[model samples]
Target: MTELLLVGIGTGNPDHITLEGRKALQGADLILIPRKGPEKSDLAELRRRIVLQSVRDGMDRVVEFDLPVRDPDLPYLEAVERWHDAIAELWAVTLAAHPDAHSAALLVWGDPSLYDSTLRIAARLDPTPKVRVIPGITALQALTAAHAIPLNTLAGSVEITTGRRLRDTGWPDGAETVAVMLDGACAFETLDPDGLQIWWGAYLGMDEQILSAGPLEEAAPHIMRIRAEARDRHGWIMDTYLLRRTGVPG
Candidate 1:
């Protein structure tokens, strides 16, 4: 039976790879890396660097596969389901091609347990494969670390949500600290921002990282402009943010 290792490699920093993740890379018979077109070429190159550094000799089989793009015509969730199925098929084909790949490693961005769906996709394999998950730094942690702020207020709760949820739900009923990830729509604007503070980071822990924070009212415009410029420059952006309603009960 093939053992599938979903290894989290952190945001974009090579150093973010944990010691256990490194060991998993070395132990793997083959490493599967995804290429997300030329616009996101840097992502693939970063994975390449990690694999090159982790594999010195003896075990030198790292394969790259083009990731399937989600169809925009279908509803978001449905498209994602179809995309994951295709990705699982790709993984199965790749694993079949490498007979010696007893333990295959898939380099996942951020922690697989977070907003990422790699683990869900892996479950779609025809024959359920044994799984090993190696955790790494998540984008939320990286965002907070880059901004030098704690994710949650003193003994306060933090709500992890997406841009879509924030837009739909306005503000959560009880949570004071909200960390939003995978927010392409810039949902921060939907909030009142009267007493809210926001810490936003893009391409966190990388050379092109942009961090901005202040009273949400004041900093919102700047973050919007910066996020737009960064996305334009890089053709893609991965960002996470922390929002706290000031003066709210903890």
Candidate 2:
């Protein structure tokens, strides 16, 4: 049976890779990098850079494959599930092509245990390869570090949710602070903005990183404008933010 290593590379920073993650990459017989199309070519390039920096053996074992796109016509959950199946099948085909490779690695953007679905897709592999995960810094960590702020206020809780939920369900009941992820839409604009403060970051650990913070009312428009400009410039953007109700002690 093949061994599959899911190594967390962290957000756009080579140094964010843990020693364990680097070791996993070096030891793997094959490294699979997914190409997410022209709009996000930088992502694949970043992974390639990380692999070259980590592995001493060169690119002989490295392989690149096109990532499957989720169908817009299908329901969200169904589309994700079907897309995952296609990825698993592709993985099997790629691995089968290299009979001698007993260990293969994929560099995950953040910890697989977080919002990532790599582990779920790996479970679909027929014959089920032995999966190993090497944890790395998460975007939340990078965001908090970049802003020099604590993730949670003193003696308070932090709720993590998506932009869709924030827009549809409003603030989670009784959550003093909420961390929003995968928010392409500025869902914060939907909120009342009263008694709210926001800390936002995009491209969190990279040179192109952008940050905005202050009362949600005052910062919302600025964040939205910059987010649009950044997305237009790069063709893609990954951002997360924390919204805290005022009156919470630091």
Compute each candidate's TM-score over C-alphas: 0.96, 0.98
Candidate 1 residues lying further than 4 Å off, grouped into runs, are: 248-250
Q: Give residue 213's error in model 1 in angstroms.
A: 0.2
lDDT of 1 by residue, 1-250 (tens): 4799998999999899999999999888888889999999999998988888777851367888898999999998899899999999988898888876688898999999999998898889989899999999999989889988888888888899999999989989998899998899899999898989899999988889889999999999999999999999999999989999888654
| lDDT for position 81 in model 2 | 91
What is the C-alpha lDDT profile of model 2 across 87-203, one tens digit per residue?
A: 999999989999998999999997898889999999999899999999989999999999999999899898999998999999899999999998989999999999999999999
Clash numbers, per candidate: 0, 0
Q: After best superposition, candidate 1 residue 196: deviation in angstroms?
A: 0.6
In candidate 2, stretches whose alpha carbon ends up further than 4 angstroms from where it belongs are none
Query: In model 2, what is the error at residue 35, expressed in angstroms?
Result: 0.1
